[model samples]
Target: MEQNWDDLRLFLAVAREESLSGAGKLLRLDPATLGRRMARLEKSLQTVLFVKSPQGYALTEAGSDLMQRAERAEQAMRAATAGVPVQSDQLTGQIRVGAPDGAANYLLPQVCAAIAAENPGLDVQIVALPRVFNLSRREADMAIGVSAPTAGRLVVQKVTDYHLHLAAAESYLAQHPEVSAVTDLQGHRMVGYIPDMIFDRELDYLADLGVGRVALASNSVSVQVRMIQQGGGIGVAHDFSLAATPGVRRILTDAVSLKRAFYLIRHADDRRNARLAAFAEALAVGLRAETARLEAATAGQAAPKA
Candidate 1:
């Protein structure tokens, strides 16, 4: 008997939706056509796959047995067809990478530039999501997240660790002379990243400091940084991001150093894809170098006042 993969697609759809009409809607087929396909699939396999009921359809024992294998096949098929070739010597394909806004803004540009330089034809899609991407569902080929992965199928690697420091505009610091230590922070106004929006663990570290009242709260770190630059109030900022922005002065470096790791995550199967592998390698190198640069800058700034 000839195996029909298309029938498996129809079978999986009905099993997932649990109703012929619902499956038809999802597959953009009419109920009658979907019913015919399911019947054909059951007949071809010589098995009763589903039992119809008032609620809809429930998978038979045989169908339940096949569901896991079928879904895995479907996922593999999707990964195989997600993109296309772009050049001769290079493996050209599109890679979807999800990361927080801070990484998207500060870290990814250098990584992207490196990928473009090495493989000009490769297309990269960067999705800036506050939460982790669903790698199992193929929502993204790779992810750069602040937290380590708890999921089983993913391959996670630590990219780097960086410090977060309390900073303010030099003018603002000059004015708030009393705000030199953790205890003094309670006397001053403060701008902070909204509770739900901070991705780094450092935010919690700061919360433990028992600092001053928040004068303003926002979800965007960029907004928090802008408010600080305009001399709104002191806020926690990554040392790397603060390097280029002038007028920001680090406050109580000894009292407020927050450190956290950045993680690079990808599905194990995707590691074989040339484009994904290349991009991951490039990203790791670029981020490490950037972290080193930031560490050096921080070290220089830590030197005693001349």
Candidate 2:
């Protein structure tokens, strides 16, 4: 019996994600279906491809060998279509973008909207969850991230620097004793990332405030912003994200401003992809403008009308 070439695609995704659920999220397939397909693929090949364990799927020797050939085939497929000329006006297909919750909540919706407007055929899917985007698994076509990747066949570019500061709702500040300095933070309730759940070092804002713990904590930045909005407690917020919230007030602005840069990342294999390249260029332009807006907003100024 001949093997199904399409199974190779599923195999590759499982190999990269090391779990059916992760691959299913990217592929939009149910886990049971993925498992059945993997089983069928394995049977057709007359060899076991993976060893399933609680941690996830581990590739067997045959699977490892197949992965090498599958990669070569993937590269060839990319090369075959690499020369297809796609003008800016003719761009189409979905582009998944991954980013931290802060960026996703405040910046990407507008940026992606502009991209979609320019290319009506393009579909932009923004993955807002704050986790490492596995581009190798097609988890996202491109990603905006707080940290530049130190390894992987990825192309990374610094987008722009933005600011963060301890902030609180006006009501919260009015009720709590005024925070006059960093040390004063210890005397009041604080909302921040759960100390142990922080996946990236850049996200450890409580430590920046010299606090050992938070009165309330969440892994999501959007949740932190919401808690602050509800007067739950003072917390670190992105200047742009907090810009539109009327009641939020920057605390210790002069004494505690932290600057961070966002990086644009894409798989090296897709570097020449016309739609991806055009979308990235548009995203960069939009991000730069947003960065300026965030800077002005943080300094108590309004961004000039575009």
CA lDDT, every model vs. true structure = 0.76, 0.85
Enumerate clash totals for all models, in the order shown: 0, 0
- In model 1, the runs with Cα more than 4 Å from the true position are 1-67, 74-89, 197-202, 298-306
Q: For residues 1-306, could you state the per-residue lDDT of candidate 1 as single tens digits? A: 545678778778788788988778757799898998888878878988899898998998988977877877776775775454534656466777888777777677777877777877778878886666767645577888888878658899899997888888877876776565787777777888676666656455457777535787776666777888889988888787777567786778887788888899998776656667767888888888887786667556743242
Expressed as tens digits, the lDDT of each residue in 168-254 for candidate 2 is: 988898788978889998888889998888988988878866898698999899999999999999899888887777788787888
**Model 1: which residue pairs collide?**
none
Q: Compute the lDDT for candidate 1.
A: 0.76
Candidate maximizing TM-score = 2
